[model samples]
Target chain A: MLTDSERERYSRQILLFGEEGQERLKSSKVFIAGAGGLGCPAAAYLAAAGVGHLVIADCDSVDRTNLNRQILHYESDIGRPKVVSAREKLLSMNPDIRVEPLAVIISDNNASTLVSGCDLVVDALDTFTDRYALNRAAIRNRIPYIHGAVSGFDGHMATIIPGETACLECMVPEAPPRSVFPVVGTTPGLIGVLQAHEAIKQITGQGEPLTNQLVLWDGKASQFTMIRVERDPDCPACGGDSRASGRRREI
Target chain B: MRVQVKAFAGFREILGPDIALELPEGSTLTGLLEGLGRRSPGIQKALFDDQGTPLKSVIIMVNKKRQTRAEFVSRELHDGDEVAIYPPVAGG
Candidate 1:
């Protein structure tokens, strides 16, 4: 049921996935956490790709320091909330898609509600404190979570499907100590696009997801390595006896 | 016995991509790490803290399987075994 304009807008990618795949993109809803470096590019790509709805949540206002990597925010948006800045650019990028920007922090209390009814969740947050909350919510909701993080010239990403693969806790058992991490913009830009690529493939049924595998990107050496990973039976968040709702659809 | 050591990210800068460590047969994981420390002080500092304890955040894997901290200290390395060590990046 694509309109003539919808068909015209997606004509290029349609050559790759066909009209059916484009419809999948037009019907999917994605919940992206954070509006920082990783989230910025991820939202931009997913928005342009015509994901029907993008629910982006963030609490911080734009700072002068964020310009190096947060592409969605401009100098004029210096003091605006991140979600507000991101939403403006995303909507303008593609008016065909819907953008729901939530101006609030995602914590243990609100994580589940924020992700409810979404087809997938993207983990673009910086701290494990908030990441873990989204992890728990994704696990409870049985939604696939695409996890990505970058530091300096290095970055890593993986997809987590509850009950089928290693959850985030199984891979990163303890949170690393937080610090003022130094980073160049390209690292996040690359990893974020990889995340968006995974999301598109997941929704369109085009390719295999990076499940039970961790992709490590070392920009300095210009190398990509895949490390096999597994679920921990005793993982506190997704351990034994924690059942992913059987009714939930598999990706 | 010969074991392969693979390092990623910052560790690669110190130990290169792969190092073949010659160890006496029956060396435990701790012994091998300590031997590596003796070979390079920079790696020792990155892998361990002031008290010589392995940093809690650095992940250690054996033949692509993640090893528990307790297992890391107790497991023995055999010939041709591959051990990986790296810290997961936490930016963006």
Candidate 2:
């Protein structure tokens, strides 16, 4: 139930989306896999929008270096765990929304359990290993996963509806090698906002989700391009005849 | 054929922003990488593993589409394809 003050706070969005959209938000459970740059803003927006439940999982702690783009943390949160700090900020943003902080690194062993309970999963993680793990879990669970990545001035986003669209593995068969890369704080924030937008679209059943498509933004050129992604018939995660798999034919 | 290469982030620091390479018409992905390495040894260190093999996480996308590490050798090239090499950077 929405309190009078709460109702007033969200009146604008409610007016736009209507009571049904608000109810959909209230009933949604979203899992955010990282609490750093992208996760910070993504979680903030979702919480502010009154998402019913948000599960934040991250193993790292706030460091001085994270201040540039990690909006959920502050100077005071340097030593605090990311999930804890993120939850604190998110709860404060909207006390009506339930925030669950899982202060642990998501691994192959626990990915399924972590993603099983959520309606959607957001891959804001910083490593390909973790992203691949989450992708596998989301595919197996038949849940929707919003993928976002930023490097320097470039960022990419995609929405994967398990068994209905191309899984992450379909695009990149193997993980890219990790490197000490460069990034501006705003890069992840921009990509994170897009991820949240896709999530909201999925939740409210409004707009066309980027299913089987990759959206690339070249900040240097200020150009955006959308490309069709074809699912590989051999994608181990979503290829076989399983309940979680989408349509077998190519899109 | 001469193709221009743009390296980003760490690669940029080592090799500057861009470089031009001249290769044979039938040069494969591996061949082009080797040619670049010969011209600028710095790129070799950044792009190859300890064994001098192309780094796995280092993505080589031709014209913005992803190409497999193995495909680098056999994947045909056109006259003006922009080959982008990227080191993995995790986003938030």
* Clashing residue pairs for model 2: A38-B92, A124-B92, A163-A245, A163-A246, A176-B57, A177-B57
* Best-matching candidate per DockQ: 1
**Candidate 2 DockQ, CA atoms:** 0.35
Q: Report the alpha-carbon TM-score of model 2 versus the true structure.
A: 0.82
Q: How closely does chain A match the true chain A in each prediction, as TM-score?
A: 0.95, 0.94
- Candidate 1, B11-49: lDDT as tens digits: 787889888988898898888888888887898987788
- Tell me the fnat of candidate 1: 0.66
**Chain B TM-score, candidate 1?**
0.93
Candidate 1: regions farther than 4 A off: A240-251, B13-18, B37-45, B48-53
lDDT of 1 by residue, A128-158 (tens): 7788889888988889999998888989999
- Lowest summed-lDDT stretch of 10 residues in model 2 chain A? A242-251
Alpha-carbon error at A154 in model 2, in Å?
4.5
Q: Interface RMSD of the predictions, in order shown?
A: 1.3, 3.1
Q: How many Å off is the CA of A120 in candidate 1?
A: 0.5
Off by over 4 Å in 2: A1-7, A151-154, A178-182, A213-229, A240-251, B1-30, B45-54, B69-74
